[model samples]
Target chain A: MLSVHSVLPSLKANATSNNMTNKINHPELCQWLKSIAIDRDKQAFTQVFRFFAPKIQRIAQSKINSEALAAEVVQDTMSNVWRKAHLFDDSKGAATTWVYTIMRNVTFDLLRKMKANKEDNLSDDIWPLAELANTEEEVFTDHIQSRNLQGIIATLPENQQQVVKGFYFMEMSQEQLAVHLDLPLGTIKSRLRLALGKLKLKLGDPHD
Target chain B: MIKHHPKFELLQGFVDGDLPASLAAGIAIHNNMCASCQQKVSQLTEQVAEASFEQSFHHKIIVNDEENLTEIAEMDFDDMINQITASDDVEPTKAIYDERSIDFKGMQYTLPSALRNIELSKTAQIGKLSRARLNLGEGEIHTSLLHIGPGGSIPEHTHKGFELTLLLAGTFADAHGQYVAGDFIMLDKRDQHQPATEHGCLCYTVANDALHFTQGINKLLNPIGAFIY
Candidate 1:
């Protein structure tokens, strides 16, 4: 969910494109976010909300079936943004990827339900807007921390790596993995267990 | 002090968001009390989000109006400049927060429908497990199929309601012992049994209720019980 407050602290009043830039550079962007989420600072949160809302809206407009629904989704995404900001790891991804992922998950969940009903009541026109690939130069590099994970996975034995990949990236079930590898179901389960234990040991303590 | 769950793979499915709704529901019930698994889920979810972010996502523009679209299109050209300047000027620490709550009750409805239609099939001789879902109006029902390799078996457990097992091929043994192809076993709430395929069994199981795990780490999956029904 995107909040106009997040995208614009002074919408229409000091709303020049330049002022928006200054707003982005505000040295406190991350700290302000921390305050709002960790400290529950309302004013700081409101600023963050305005600055990011437009982007969030742009996101929802692209995915949901209707503008109204898109607006709702953006709103939901933003709220989660507020609540989960503390959960965000800057080392892992940029603010954009973080926000967009929330939007995507919420949209995917919505689409799944609508698809289930098999209802075609909503026309595509009513949707806010679809995502545009060529419009911006947002690179996926913002979230490159995953390369570290891949690196960690690479250190595992080929069999363990395949097990993790098949389950996580390929979205295979344990039963499916067992059948595909021609291993006993128990063996499949044991390999996955061993793989995770190794990951936990290798990856820094998750709690920290 | 974390106990190793026998169904870690199942929990992996939960963290990765791929478990069938019924199975997920069963796991959810367990997650509430299991801090270790809960922490594991949180860490894994973060990994997923991070992985997704690494893959370049080109937001597809689906809007049709040329004029408004063009305006946003032009806005994109200047977006990086705006972002750069904003980053440079803003202390970022002072950024304010938004207060309104965004409701996402809509996404919850999709969970059930998504799990309703997966086909159980595999190239291996062991066969596959498939759930043939039937929309019964009041609620949904489905028959779960299990094709055991020779000597394969579904572990024993209890059902919340009535469970009927119809042997389709090979043979299986439950707490009550053995059954051949064409044999039918009906279990009620009071029934508790471990089923093993002696020569690897193939059976169609119609469970009207969820499994109530009485022992073992399978109980960790109880939180995700909603999807099973």
Candidate 2:
């Protein structure tokens, strides 16, 4: 068993002093979190929170317009992190994915409550991909796979490709797409559904 | 012909971490049983990972934080684990009710102070056969564990987001059928059904979002259904 002092050698170094933008998973940091999380280590939690709080803030701000609301969402999400630390099983899901899922849920809840009756607008920046930890090894693997997917998507018809981008990258609702193109709601849904099905086929997704 | 699940696209959204909570929870419940959907989810997950790895669009979210709250949290996680692993025969909390004891079919369900006036009490559960309550998003979601005795039932209902029920003891049957101890049942907005305990049951349910009662006729009778979620 590593002593707290021995494991926390870089604790002070990792603390936010000058607003340093560090990678999500600094090896020493992840190790410290794993130790604290399993053992309910407080020092480790503080270090991890200070580092990730900004990222949470960023997600909330970029997605939701209100800074105060975004801050509240971050605080709520952080409190959840504290409470559910024991539930984290590394084998099932990554820490990054788990946190993003929480943020996504919170954001969705807020948006849903605020805009219960209003139609969703697609032109706005609605769909932003959640962040994941990236390592050097993952980068190499991704380069090859992305090149393949990019090539496949390029082969799709212009209309299908546009809808895919509009839905996936832009996060437009089917209604929004319909309104944007002056098409029937059914047409937009069918088009996006068919386009995705074909893309999955070309990508050789198992379901296809 | 196996009609492709409507959730194929929804699962894709979930894998990509883009779907709304209600939709994602619905898809998750379905995915728990469908291997085909799981495969598609895995594929989408791979694509997402690849897209993220090449050049992550934004900063990553870290779920675990071992900081200021650690002092109170340093208490053994094993306590929870033990509670989870312990047999139902060994009762940890009280079944006896003094003033707080709820009498339903001769079984006592002790109400915690936080939930004393909440009206989700044992009697209320039994009296109303088919009812639903929208919790109005109150209380600490997972802390209070609810126990439903044998033959006890909660009327047909749907959730706004996600509902996780880990059966600690006994059995319960819903529209989807029966579930026993050690069986973790998840439900979402898309699902609507009643759950009834058989041979007595103890369950820990964690609900995110609200509960919607589909039996519209019952809603008119129980105006204060504000509590039964």
Error of 1 at B24 (Å): 2.3
Q: Per-candidate RMSD vs. true structure?
A: 18.5, 15.8
Q: Give the Å shift of residue A200 in candidate 2.
A: 3.2
**What's the residue-level lDDT of A157 in candidate 1?**
82
lDDT of 1 at A176: 56
What are the lDDT scores of the predictions, listed in order? 0.47, 0.48
| Per-residue accuracy of model 1 over B1-229 as CA lDDT, tens digit each | 2222214455556554343333443344334333444444444554544333221111111122232322333123133323332321222333343332111211111112112233333212222222333231212434444455555444446777766565645666766666765444556788887677655554555566677666777577553232233
The fraction of reference A/B contacts recovered in model 2 reads: 0.01
Q: Which digits, one per residue and each the tens of the lDDT, describe model 2 over residues B66-107?
A: 221112212233342333223222222223324554443455
Docking class of 2: incorrect
Candidate 2: interface RMSD equals 14.3
Model 1: lDDT of residue A154: 71
Query: Over the stretch A54-112, how does candidate 2's per-residue lDDT look in tens digits?
Result: 55665565467566777666665555555555544454545655555556556665665
